[model samples]
Target: MQALFILSVWTSLVALGCLAPFVLALAYVWVDLFRPHDVAPALGQLFPFSLTTAVLTLGAYVLVDRRDPPRLGLLTALLIIWAGWITLTTTWALYPTAAWAKWDWAFKTILFSTLLPFFFRSRIQIEAALLVILCCIASNVVCFAIKSVLASGGYGRPLGLIQINAGWGGEGSTLGTYAFACLPLVAFLQRHSIVAPSRGWLRWVYFAAPVIAVIGAFGTFARAALVACVVWAALLWWRSRHKFMVAIMLVAGAAAVVPLMGDAWKARISTSFAPRQDESANTRLLVWEWTIGLANQYPAGAGFNGYLGNRFVTQDEWGEDNVQEGRAFHSIYFEVLGEHGWVGLAIFLATFAVFFLNMRSVRRAARARPELEWIGDLARALSHGVLIFMAGAAFVGIAFYPLHYYLLALAVSTSAALHRATLSSADRAPQESLADLAVGHNAARLPAWRQRAGQTKASI
Candidate 1:
């Protein structure tokens, strides 16, 4: 009891530490997804801890100490606009209540994402942010691994687990998406460690973290996530300066995981090719077909939870007996289209396009400058993660997922910082050169004048 009391006291102190807000943000992301109430009921009960910390941090940022103005870019502007549009759509939505609920969630996500850029100013802070995310995912991996072990009696899951819980009553696919997004950050940390000798500890995490993440993704038996992993791995290999080494690592990793993938797992993934046989796949197709019909009929859109109301209406009018009930928009593109209309979808796509283009440019800029290479590597990883999400979105609904916007903010902020650094360096260069020239001129005159003085004295 004494030990427990002491431990509780220590925990409280840690929570109240100077860096508590950042830590709380990570904890919020984890608990929001994992819902580890059984593991730590105290923390679990404090479910709103993350949001509370975020609000507190924002207050601190504004009032506690005067800080520089936040670095806002195209992505930030677009995100705010996107949030406003989402709110506007709620008014015209088929179900205002449902739309309002979604709007509330989106508002929180956008607010948190917008606040992220302000927190990350230095490389260490950025890396720390990356670490926070990695740790959150790691918690999920550990939880899932334990569940798999218990379910399989330590032999391991033969077909992988189905619908691993990821807090807020979410499913394995959601966890898989989270893992997929984070993989690139893991790679970035690893690469950063190699480039910067100071972060030597990350090298170990680099090797271990990816394997765990892969396991976590596979455990979910999420085919889309697995596909994303393949794409990511390929991209990583292509970007690697050491192709041979990366290839060897990939081969070795595959060899290790192949034995663990039993026939059931193999068969499940193979269904990706023969999606018709899968009930889920068949339903998705029908949903998509229904979506197209609705899109044509209502070009303006249904507005927030519009699919539910529109689906019933469409069926009665179009009167298709074979059509399934209107389901959640499985695809992000389709979701935005259904809720916000073609105009919303266009803006959504445009936002992503602009954000990605900026990242690519940042990558090129970082690569060109040796000092900013870390930022470049980060850009590359973020862009790859975004691509994975883009493809993964077709399989699942995550249009308003916080991670997506957070990553965009990350990319934009990192790019802005790099440019600012470059400009600062450029500004200092001419001043430095002028100083050097003046010093040289003074030295030359001193020697000549000294010689003249000596000659004059000798002649006298």
Candidate 2:
């Protein structure tokens, strides 16, 4: 029954995409984030949902939605270069089989990201994309948040929609990271949403979504989530117009929530401050050390899944030595460094830096226009979300995850939209001014002509 329902919904979305090509883009995002195939086993076996949507979306873009293509900017160029570099590195991967498997998805993610701006060219299209992403994220985290309240969450516990701890939705740390990172977008929707009517029930849903997301983050029992929350809060306060009030609210909210934290949650978060005390934290340190050593041996990177060959030793609290092998690189920086080498890592970092600058430029340009204030707000929200993700990614290996790439694509789309809107406005301003001047000139002559007529009649 669930499978049938999901298939029906997917079919309906595809039907809508036939009329509006951009709907295909949103449908693609929905498939990526929700992973409905994973939710329903029958659906998974029947066909590849993500692949189907990707093909449909690309086809629509080429056949119908090619009217206004986005400008090929520096950010897109960097991503293309980055993608090419990673593909080259795959030839020398320590684990060729594993590398190829990862490359299959990672390359697609980069390619899709670059093309996203082309599909979403307008403000409404961009906002709709954001809303879909937010809702998909919420669908996973909101459930986890409810479970956390009913049953106090523990580290390594399966608390999300899925019972596995693998992908973004299944993994505790990654899920929590995404939950907090998405908070800013939630706030953006509440204030500037055009898709959802700004009146009654939907407004309340927007108001409660962030609170639920925070709870879901706590439910993961991930120290990374806690750190991300603090970083996001600080960034939020810094960006707020009423800084003092925001600070006060933050403090009051923390005070209210702190008492509800379970002992397991408290214990897990405290370990973040003292890494040496926790086994997981200690393992991350060992993995990072191994990655650095690998980078020294292969400065150009060993390719994707290079960490598969990692071998290291760690000393326990009791002074016992334990050997670890094939441990994952927990940090995004190290993940790229180990897999792609230093050069790849440099390219990856450069891509991120360029993205941040793009968002900054958009915000600055949009803020000056009263009508485009929503664009400025969207840019701010995206930047904040990216920052939060970066903070959390310090301890998680999601370098190739769909979430960050999607955010980058949204940023690009936003920058492009601002550029187009600004140009359109600039083109109209001169014509409008000239029209106003002509009207004033006609009005000024009308009274003088009427007086001349009256004097002619008096002379007669």
Candidate of highest lDDT: 2
lDDT of 2: 0.87
What lDDT does the true structure give each of the candidates? 0.67, 0.87
Q: Name every residue pair that clashes in candidate 2.
A: 301-340, 301-341
TM-score of each: 0.82, 0.94
Off by over 4 Å in 1: 1-47, 149-170, 193-202, 242-252, 309-326, 448-460
Model 2 quality (TM-score): 0.94
- Model 2: per-residue Cα lDDT over 1-460, one tens digit each: 8788889878888999999999998898888888888777667888899899999999998888898778888888998998899999998888899999999989988888888888888878888898889878887798788888897766677776666777788888898899989988888888888887556999788878768978888888887888899998899898789999999999999988877886767777888889878877988988898899999999999999998887767777798988888999998999999999999999999988998888888888877789989889988888889889999999999999988888888888888788788789889999999998986676567788876775698799
Model 1 lDDT at residue 348? 89
Ten-residue stretch with the least lDDT total in model 1 = 153-162
Off by over 4 Å in 2: 315-321, 440-460
